[model samples]
Target chain A: MMLKKVVVCGVGLIGGSFALALKAAGAVGEVVGLGRTQASLAAAQQRGVIDRIASDWADALHDADLVFLAMPVGQVASVLVSMAPYLSSTTVITDGGSTKVDVALAARQALGAQCAQFVPGHPIAGAEKSGVAAARADLFYQKRVVLTPLAENTEAHIALVEHVWQACGAEVSRLDAEDHDRVFAAVSHLPHFLAFALVHEFAQRADSAQLFGFAAGGFRDFTRIASSHPEMWRDICLANRSALLVELDAYMVELMRARVLLAGADAEGLQAMFDTARTRRDAWLDGLTPPGE
Target chain B: MMLKKVVVCGVGLIGGSFALALKAAGAVGEVVGLGRTQASLAAAQQRGVIDRIASDWADALHDADLVFLAMPVGQVASVLVSMAPYLSSTTVITDGGSTKVDVALAARQALGAQCAQFVPGHPIAGAEKSGVAAARADLFYQKRVVLTPLAENTEAHIALVEHVWQACGAEVSRLDAEDHDRVFAAVSHLPHFLAFALVHEFAQRADSAQLFGFAAGGFRDFTRIASSHPEMWRDICLANRSALLVELDAYMVELMRARVLLAGADAEGLQAMFDTARTRRDAWLDGLTPPGE
Candidate 1:
């Protein structure tokens, strides 16, 4: 059997890491990296993440069986539509965008019947750093990657995408685009929003540097996501505003309850609140116990 | 040189760990553990965290030049006042309490002229787990142990406490209790508050089990503090409420602004907000690039 030819567009962190994973799994015969920056394309090739580099998108996709649009979430639509001119009807298109609803919608409008081959995906793995320079082959190992497929999606197309993810060592789950958005809004978007809000608030405080100086490991890790790409996050928050807003309100109500309990010096009530949380979260930890290798 | 005799009261996590640190450093000739529980005292001695277990408070203070009271902030003053009956005028006492302002004042009212000898200290090192069994010799290594000593504190007393921290491999910083409370309110208490709020908000969502399943590394680390000792945290939140409430107000204001920005889909404003936080916190990461061991 001939190996699949894989093309990764916008060879930054996500795209570069995916290319590395595909090559490592021996699932792809050759990886072609296409990035806007000529220097970045060279960097990706130099890192051995890709066998070849293409400065132009069409050149990279010319003989590829799979094309991955790993650009910023906001840029996924326009880039996908732009690639429409060079796309073969048989080619399988996939994305690793953070926000899925918009990307899934874009696939429908841009590719229509061909959208059956476009699998919208989101891998819940990242570091604060960005670009191809920060790419690692094992970034997606043991991570959860959610796929949002419409009724138009064919089983063969889904199998091809699922095979790639399995080869990359990801735990794959399928859900509707709207459900994906709501779920991610709680787990991912709210966290990023809180992280951004926290550090930004401290930056504007009088003793900003000193405040950061006193910050220990917990604070650093908690706020690390605040250091992610602003352009990407801003697009994510706007795209999924209603869901994010609801989670935000829920957090506020809980916080005020704790605050009021503290104000009254109700030690018993406060301890009970913490006890309940610890019990619930401990159950979660036990379920995923020992962590995946 | 003769090793100093040291007594650690309430041999739970903090006291047991302190005794272990002191004994490991060879700073104490005889490390004695005193607590309310017989099982913990037995574990402390069996683990070599203490040379012997002292069942009575008066007996524990007999030959000690130094004493460390490692109890909740709310209980620190009463314990000191009771133990004062048997303490020698020259024997210096210290505490591992979270809030120094109240403890310092309590020392003043209870210890009177002996307040100069009761140094207020807090070691900012801990884990989710507590008890004598969890005690380790290296717990305080490379950790910060802040001392809040008043003007009446004699040089000999302050130096004695500083020497103990140095022996335990802790970096010691001396600051006024009020400033200590203000700084920690932002760095420690506020993060706990936010973590508790987040866990309560999302961990109780409709699909909490799945959200917990997909929670990434960052989320797990950020929320780990929510699993801390509830009774202990209740005392921390209440004793330090004045400073913590201020920090809470500041955070809520920032959250309000973030809500408006997200609600209005203000892309540029949100982008700027995230960008500034990224630059600021990334600088923190750069500045504290961990020193080679």
Candidate 2:
């Protein structure tokens, strides 16, 4: 199915890449950019990520077959409220929000009956860099895109979102909104939180420079996510706080166990844990499609 | 000053790379390999990481100008005790142990008066892959090699160690043994522990498969160190337990603060911490020399 006009709100890495991917797939005729900044929209247009920049929700949703919300999670409620009146019945809405439950709540509260059109999604792809300049058509290639369909969403509307993600070279799967948030809080948000906390702790130390000076490849990779967008991660942490707290507490228990092992010099126990982690991680890595293939 | 002969114990990634680097720099005449396994030593010899596989400490240390102990931290004490009888008065010794204080103690207990000849060092360079096969002549190129010299170490002996690391294209810096352990416990060891704990915690969960399936780039990098050599890390953690425990406890405090911020939905506080972390990490990354230069 071809989308004659697709409106992408945000015009940054996620939105711009989505627009470019759809155009490259020859599945979208025109991509309209809508965002908080006209300059960023102009940047997306210049980068060929969007065919045009929309000045208002009225113009953006006019004849739009799909509307993608790709902004930070915290902005979803207000943006949905602003665009709700302009959304046509046939215009299926989806999002690239990392947290699904919060975005689903925002859509339900804002769109009311039209929330049926909103299929909450999260594309499991990112880079160290962000913004329109970092956007690439192949960003979603071989990546996973999870959809958390609301009870109000019709099969056809959910299928439309799935088709769009598939057309962009992504593998699509569905999960309940609550399950989506909980799983991601355990896998994604919790790790990001730990990384940020570790880095921040080191940065606040008196010998931070000396400590960082000795940090090598392991330290580099382990804390790489600490370099992610602060406001974006902050929103995610707060949005998925309950699930994240559960993860954080579980992790603390694990760390405490590790400390006990270290304190008692339990070499066998520590090695067992590390071995299990490595074995599982290696198996998962082996199952993945290597990038750039 | 070129080495007439160099003996490397435990010819794995760290030791194998050192032999190769020294050979590439024409800093040593002959390299002798000594390890617990003859098979690995033979493999190192076949890869040209060592000129010969020595049958004993006497065979390895005979006429050797330097002895480089590159074994796991747990093996160092026993190895030092084994080699102490063969060590000549002028044979300056060094190590690539990740922990300094423990290695220092090992040297003192095993070598006694000969401890002055041992210059404790840690090369801040590593890859996800290990073993002699993964060794490269350029492994230490542009990397940091920290020397934690003993009070009894003569300036000339310490200079010889520094010059050798420099010949391998490393920038050598000196820190007190105590300071080295403390700094590295915070920067390097703590991050690895956290990564391993995070991965192990998830791997043990009932929903492990689901959580891992939804995991993305952030999770990948954050837990990359979880795939490290389990035995090696266990030894490092145990050897440097005191300092690592301090760092780990401090990090838990930081994580607790983060939890409070999330629980309270204090968006401003969470963003501030993330901002600080990202800013510091970005600056640290900027100051690093780009690899392969």
Candidate 3:
């Protein structure tokens, strides 16, 4: 097989989906799931996301060709620290965290001598659904997977990780960790925060029920991301705090300008701003293939 | 026929769709379109949205039993003033403006004694697409249509307008003009403004192309309204300025609080806010029938 044994840490949506995709592509002989909870690991096994469960990092790393860390950002550091002693010199490690800088630093501190083997990555694919039950073999099909390799990583290590992603039908691209954090903070994290904030504001109003009853498809689509897993978003917001703050500031300034335009009944100014955004968004959407294509 | 003749002003997506729906339900004997431009009127007629085009409001109102003022909020006032001189005492008039208060005042000032026949309405249905080309007979099927009747409007006039909407497969409800504006300001106008502002901000960034390239489906859906017709939104924002400004202020306060929470790494606070929002949004979604159902 392309890989003799693959261990997927935290076998929920991301980790479980990756293992299933790799297995479907015949890229690995055996896939073992590693998680603290037996219930989740059992569920992952039942879903065929992993062939078996690993009791601990020692068991998970034993003769494992690759390890994919797909846990919450908050837990990635601790897991890496615990797995450091058991990691084989030949084992290549990669991650699927949304935020990369923190995870990269975690690897540097936790892996120490073996840091070069750990390639930090983020698969830019997901659904609103979560957990092992939501995992699918073709979750990564035609999706983008971004790798933010550490300075210590060797060319061979990066290639091996890229090969695994390609086999799963994902297109691979490389960026520095900081750049990845900034880009995602603006495009993904900031939008989630805004959606959540808008929903929260509405929920706190006295006429929330009446207002929500009047809401149609537009409000539903705009706030869909607010339905994301709470703890996962919380961790992402905290982990990528600096970059997210900058984006939020930029968004706030734009909002303030719009408020002024509306207050003054400046139709020309408002239309110009909207026209620019509409033109840009339409052009951007035209270039994208629909999801799963 | 339920109505002898119907005249629809503006003849864009909203107007065209309403005319088509009424025609499909066999509620009107003849449907005439009125617009400032001949091109849009010709297009609407070619698409069978209307039976014929009127060179002026006077010509359209010649023998009409009902008239639909389905123009932008900014144009609604001027159209009402122009049509007032030709409006027959028996003609029941209504509008599909996003804001109700301004339209109510406009009808009062423009129609004079005929104001009793004018019913202000806001139909809560639309697509990102616009124009007569995007019109569909079922556009208002299962959609909510809120009517904010003026004090001068006779019960018979309101019922006639409601009957027409019911025949078109829309659920009709009543609200005060002021209340309708407040509710829609929070739910629709504010959200559209926020989306436009976000997209506008991103477009102005130096790395805009790269950043937009990384945006996913969630971003696309959340900002879909940003691609709405610019002049249309500008008019709505201005027409409902007072109510919109109140909602915008509340939204700004919420955004500021979120910024503080993120800056301070308040995970517990952030999670609590997100959880509340997620629970509410999920509940709201559960109540909605999927689109086109």
Candidate 4:
């Protein structure tokens, strides 16, 4: 086996799925799920997502060669701090947090001299569902996994983390933590926030039922992300506050421009804007081969 | 056949699909395709979306029992005005325009004394694809078709339109022209505009390629409507200006509130907003039995 023992913290969709993928690839000797809930860890073990359950990181870390923090962004720092006391000098740590800048900082603060082993990462794959029950071994297949290795991280540590992701059938790429935060804030975080806002605004309306009744496919697709886990999104938004704010402002500016065009009845101008977007979006869609395709 | 002859003006996706659906139901004696271009007309005829091509509405209306103006919103008025001179007193008229208020007003002005036969409708069915080639007989199956009958419309005309839609396997409902415009502006037009704006904004960014490269399924689904026909959306926006402007302002207000919440790092408030949206969206999705489900 590539690793003697690997611990997956949180044991939810991302954690469970990662553990299962690692086991399927035979990349580890033993996969232990570490979570706050015994029931969830038990479920993960029963489903073969993990070979064993870790009641606490200390016990799990004693013989572990690798650690994966697949928990919510809000809890990543505290967990890192708690486990730092037990982490072996040879063990490598990586995370599946959506925001990297804060996560990298948290690892640095929590692990101190051992920060070189902690690699901040985000695997861009998910569904509306959550929990260990929703986990699958193929969840990361053909998906993108971005790693923002800290300045303190050694080349060997980075390679080990990248190796795990590659074995899981994910395309791995590296970016600076700040750059990762900015790009994802614009593409992922902002869109999720806007979707939630759209749904909330409609629900607050007096004719909400009528408005929702009239909403068709477009509305459904546009707001589908609004159905995501609330606490997860909340943590993402708060963790990547500055970058998300910048993106939100940029998006607001675009919305205002559209509003001006509509208010002025500028049909030609509106058509030009929509045409540009259509052409670009179509080209982008043509490039992507979705999973089933 | 329930009807002696039916003429489908424009013969694009909506027009062609409607014609095919009616034909599949054996609801019409002869379906004639009318368009500005002979290529499109011939394409529709070859695809069996229509039985024959009409060189002009004058000849097409001679024995027509019904006429469907399935053109862009901007052309609906002119087409109705052009066909008015040849419309028989017994001929019933309906349109598949996205906006209702303007179409209803146009029909009144164009048809004059014959306004009683015109019904304005907005079918809640479509895809990113256009043209007769993309048309399908089952496009409207299990979809909602909203009709905004003019004050001058006769009960018989309304019944005929309802019967035709029902024959197409659509759930038909009635709404006032103004209310229809208001609700659709909020749900449809606003969402389309926002999606287009999002794509336009991102495309204008210096790192657009990288931004798009990292976009996941949520981004794809949210902006899927951005690939819609530009001219079609332009006409809808212009035709429904007043209501659209009102909805846009309301949306801007909501956006600004979100901005404030984010700027202040109000985690509790943000979570509350996201939770509300998640609950409502989940409920709505649970209620829907999507196509083929």
Q: TM-score, each model?
A: 0.96, 0.97, 0.97, 0.97
For this target, which candidate reaches the highest DockQ against the unseen true structure?
4
Tens digits of per-residue lDDT for model 2, B1-293:
79999999889999999999999999999999988888898899888899998889888888999989988899999999999999999899999999999999999999999999999999998876678998999999988899999998999999999999999999898999899889889888898898888888988889999988888888888888888888889899999999999999999999898888889999999999999999999999988875446
Score residue B224 of candidate 3 by CA lDDT. Answer: 88
Q: Each candidate's DockQ score against the native complex? A: 0.72, 0.85, 0.86, 0.88
RMSD of 4: 1.8
User: What is the per-residue lDDT of model 2 for residues A1-293, given as tens digits with 9 covering 90 to 100?
Assistant: 79999999998889999998999999999999999988998888988899998889999999999999988899999999999888889899999999999998998999999999999999999876778998999999989899999999999999999999999999999999999999999999898899899899989988888887777788888888889889889889989999999999999999999889988889999899889988889888987775436
Model 1 misplaced stretches (Cα beyond 4 Å):
A289-293, B1-3, B289-293
- Give the lDDT of residue B72 in candidate 3: 83
Q: What are the interface RMSDs of all the models?
A: 1.3, 0.9, 0.6, 0.7
What is the per-residue lDDT of model 3 for residues A101-178, given as tens digits with 9 covering 90 to 100? 999999999989799999999998887778888888888888899999999999999999999999988988999999
* CAPRI-style docking class of model 4 based on DockQ: high
- The alpha-carbon lDDT assigned to residue A175 of candidate 1 equals 82
The alpha-carbon lDDT assigned to residue A79 of candidate 3 equals 92
Question: Which parts of model 2 are misplaced by more than 4 Å?
Answer: A290-293, B290-293
Over the stretch B76-107, how does candidate 3's per-residue lDDT look in tens digits?
88888888888888888999999999998888
- Cα error of candidate 1 at position B63, Å: 2.0
DockQ of candidate 3 (2 decimals):
0.86
For each prediction in turn, the share of the native Cα contacts (below 8 Å between chains A and B) that it retains comes to: 0.66, 0.91, 0.84, 0.91
Please give the distance, in angstroms, between residue A271's alpha carbon in candidate 4 and its true position after superposition: 0.6
The TM-score obtained for chain B of candidate 3 when compared with the true chain B: 0.97
Full-model lDDT for every candidate: 0.84, 0.91, 0.91, 0.90
